[model samples]
Target: MSDGADTGEAGEPGTEARPGLVRRFLLGLIVVLPMSAALIAGGAFLYGKWRFNAPGPAAAPTVVWLAPGHGLSSIAERLREAHVLDETGIFRLAVELNRAAGALKAGEYEIPAHASMADIVRILREGKSIVHRITVPEGLTSQEAMEIVRADPVLTGDMPPVPAEGSLLPETYNFSRGTTRAQIVQRMQKSASALINEAWPHRTANLPYKTQREAIILASIVEKETGLAAERPKVAAVFVNRLRKPMRLQSDPTIIYGITGGKGPLGRPIRQSELDRVTPYNTYQVDGLPPTPICNPGRASIEAVLNPPETNDLYFVADGTGGHAFASSLADHGRNVARWRQVEKKAVQVPVKAAEERTAGTKPVIPLKAPARHVGG
Candidate 1:
């Protein structure tokens, strides 16, 4: 107590030791605050990463539609609503971190079950949408093909005007949802034009047709004459030979088209009165190719017309075997008709009755001098 200075043991408290205690407290705070903050930040980062990689809530594969002009936030919300994701925050974070925020595409997508948030982002950024197809079969008229496009539930918008006959290609066209019907029709037309352009250059020399349109006209007839793929070349050859000989095409489908105007199927066999009618499309009456295509011809039919094989066949009639009996002479064609009438007597009754019933019970007799003048003869 000589100078009355504060004195205490090292562990005891006193006024002089207060400064030391304060220094230690400040030092502890300095070290602990950074450590605590780092721990908290690490925990938050791990949680976000886990959510980003975790399996989604979709029980099965679910379809999600992202409309055009939607931002990233809107897409995330759509994903959450579709149950493809439990939340949107982690998904947004992941997409942003991967530097793919602007790469997401809009369309119909099929998200698989248990797909992680990373998987969803990757799918959208990669534009992996579901593919839908509309198959337009060969020999369908433009009106019929457009009817198919109009009836599709997935495609959007009203159909455009019916295209010209033989102007649209018949194939399985692929598209995503929300595609317009008009766009599909235009695509079909473009494909058809492209095909003709490509095939016209390689056409066989000395074709009877003077223009590409005439080629399409013949191809359309060939398409309707036979449904068998193997018979296309022969049927085309018959017509080509007939054209060279200046003989009548005498096709039944042309007669039907003249009667119905390619609006729909005739739904009955062609009658003699219809065939004898002097319409522009009735090949039996018309001298050469029809004014327009009867129906849309496929690629095979077009190719068959442009590059017919070498043959002298001038006549063809249905042989009751889902094919035609081709002959180079009228006598051979008549014999083939007789054989067909014998083999398909019951099948013959259908067309005969169709012709007779429409014409006041006047029966058609197969003349021996000319080809069989009945349907599928």
Candidate 2:
């Protein structure tokens, strides 16, 4: 009986130990399996980060347009298509990881060569799109300037009615895509008004014009008078001197504006009858400044009229060298006029000399008085 009892005790210990061994094996599996899984997950995260920051495959700068309402998945796909990103999955994962899915904006973007996925992500998040600019050159009539704006392919929407003449500023304007045409016109008008307000206070004292409109009116004439930058201040002085003397301005541009209404340049030279015809804008017949500005004047011309150099010059005539000769007295003006007539005479003879040679002893008739005209005072 004692031998049988000892054998049972030994067998009981073996049975208990088998269960403990099985439990230990299961616990080890639970701990080690999770550690292995965590290591794998961490390695994947680090590799993803490296790929997100790695340079893209684009060989040159690429321009991409992200339209409004584009989802993150679509943006990622587009970036892949444009060769800006290697794969869309990584871009999507990176954007989702950074919590920037909702921060992305729509617009045109110029991506640099070798831009990283991370760099592109930040750019779209901050809405840093490409900037576009259009320049309206100085001295364009309002109608002419509006035509330029209307012709731009980037700007959207129908243009508003043409603004009043000389009300729009002629300058380079910057805008984004999808900007309305009306907004651009408003910006121009605002710039014009702002410039007048800023420059009116600093004008020369005892100027002939009393109001801002009159100053602009005279400035428009100065803008049309000469294309030379150095001559603007001097030309403004001439008109100012004439206004002070109560002498007629007799500007040729003003007469042309009266006939064409600032729609465009008169294709032909001023005829003698058109000069003599009575009109509200005819400076030869009118006593003072015109009723309104003939065209949009730029900042230099506007500023020149406001602070013209002190001078007594009253007359200007073309010098046949794409500029005008200024004179302070009528006698000096007459001399300048005689020299200009010689220049004109030479210009006419060169073209018509062949015809004159066809008929022997017959002189080419180039009228000395108002013989087809040039813009002069």
Candidate 3:
């Protein structure tokens, strides 16, 4: 009995120790591999964060333009090409994690100095882009205004179709980087229509304008006659009085529009030869308002023709100042024309610098708008 008990005790020690050895190996494995994996994962995650958040290579405020229809991958490549990023993989992952890959907008963005990838992505997602303003002044022909729009550096895309003359309203318009020229022209047309619709009903009675189109035509002339805002009503009165008698409008702007088709300025003073030249738009030869408006008249100019001040004046000439001198009688008009010639003579004597100051705004110049018929009228 004693020998059998000793042998069982020895076997028990060996069996218990084998189980302990297996338990120790399992515990070590569970602790070691997971901990090692965690350390590696943590290192990768920290590296990604640091790279994505680091400042870009731009030393100054830079403009970044993303064209329309570009995907996130293309944009990322562009950024890397612009030297704005060191690596693109992290940026891609960050954008995906934020679910912003499809939300990028096309526009010109003014990125700050040292902008991080996250900063750029946030800006692109939010569409915080650049805004540019273009102001179209009153009385510009559609062609002239379009020239300005075409030359603008802010707008993009192909040049839009030129609308009918006097279709666009004169005002300041705002646009983003990728805004098309056609879009701006369409906007102007809408604005002009609104102004016309608003002011058409308020025009004076017996205006001799058979249609709203005729009034707009007359308003365009009034706009071209003078640059003075205060003079618009008086200018409108001259045309209105003549129209009351149904006399020839005989405006010089009509003569110029006939010559150039509103595509460019006459670039010189009107001559007697050009005045006698018969054209559809020439008011001297035509009986009524021209076929269409000569230029895009502003709201005030349109308003002036719609509600002109009371006056008996039928003729006007420049009063040596920017404004015009008015007269009711043909004799008085002739006298005014004579004085205007004298003023013109004296103006020719002006120093080049002084003349430069007189028309410094570079608005179209009107020279010798009056001829023999205007003096007689």
Candidate 4:
């Protein structure tokens, strides 16, 4: 009986050792699994932080014009393609976490050199975009202005046909990127109409113009004649005084318009033949204002015509300077014209003499003294 008991005990002893080994294995797993999971999660968090805060890959400061319907995911993909971001998928995920995917605004955005992905996201969400400006100078024909609009690469839309002359108000227009050209033209027209409405009511009393159209037609002539802002009121007065006498307008710009139909620059000085040509727009031969405005007049020119300076000056001739000298009498005008011719003679000789001196390696001649007086001399 003792020997049988010993054999059974020996077999059961191995079974007991196996159970002990199994318990140790399970305990080790229980302790190591949580630690491994913690290490992995911590590593992932650190990697995300590094990526989110790191500078982007753009070589220089860049501008991205985000158009309408550009989603955050799409933008991220584009950034990845441009090497601006290393991980587009991670960027998209970050955007979702921030809850900003749906709030981004479309505009021209300046991305700083080496900006973080997070910086870009915040910039888009905050709607910080670059504003662009286009300044249409005063006195450009509508055709010329439309050419300016068509040439701007930033503006998008179907180009409108050339508008009528004197229609658009020339001014600096501000817009965000992706603005249409047609909208700008509409704004200009509306501004011009509004200005005319405001100024027409306060025009000088006893003016020959029965309608605002006449004033605009006359103002455009004055605009093309002189660039001097201060001289506009006097120029308007000279034309107005002539109109009262019922004399011909006789504006040189009108004759030029009659020849070219206001399409472009005549590219040369007016000839006697062109001045005598009897077109509907020819003020040299016509009895009153031209059929329409010669060019797009500015607000100042329009206002000047509507409110001319108090003067009875009948004629004005170019003085020795760029400005003109006014005369109320024909004899005074003849003297001014003679002085202007002398100034013209000197002007013609100056460039020729300068070139000759340069060719001969001689010192330049002193500037000729301006006439002591233009109108009275």
Best by TM-score: 1
lDDT of candidate 1 over 66-124, digit per residue (tens): 99899889999999999998888888887888888889999999999989998898899
- Stretches off by above 4 angstroms in model 1 are 1-13, 346-377
RMSD (CA, Å), each prediction: 6.3, 4.7, 5.8, 4.6
**Which residue pairs clash within candidate 3?**
none
Ranking 1 against 2 by TM-score, winner? 1
Per-residue lDDT, model 1, residue 8, is 34
What's the TM for model 3?
0.79
What is the C-alpha RMSD, rounded to one decimal, of candidate 1? 6.3
TM-score of each: 0.88, 0.86, 0.79, 0.81
**What tens-digit string does per-residue lDDT give for candidate 4 at 320-340?**
666889988888889878878
lDDT assessment of candidate 3: 0.84
Ranked by lDDT, the better of candidates 1 and 4 is: 1
User: How do the residues 190-298 of candidate 3 rate in per-residue lDDT, one tens digit apiece?
Assistant: 9999999988987777777767787788889989888899999988998888888877888888888888898888888788888787888878877878889999999
Q: TM-score for candidate 1, please give it.
A: 0.88
In model 2, what is the error at residue 348, expressed in angstroms?
A: 1.1
lDDT of all predictions: 0.87, 0.87, 0.84, 0.83
CA error at residue 203 for candidate 2, angstroms = 0.7
Candidate 1 lDDT trough over 10 residues, lowest sum: 367-376
Error of 2 at 2 (Å): 9.2
Off by over 4 Å in 3: 1-15, 28-47, 133-137, 149-161, 202-206, 276-279, 329-335, 348-377
- State the lDDT of candidate 2 residue by residue for 1-377, as single tens digits: 99989887776446768888999999999999999999999888888889889988998999998878889999988888889988888889888888999999988999999999999998998898988898988878898998999999998899899889889888999988877899999999999999999999999999999999999999999998888888999899999998899888888889889998888988788778987888889888778988988899999999999999999898888877777888998888989889988987787666477576558766655433333243333
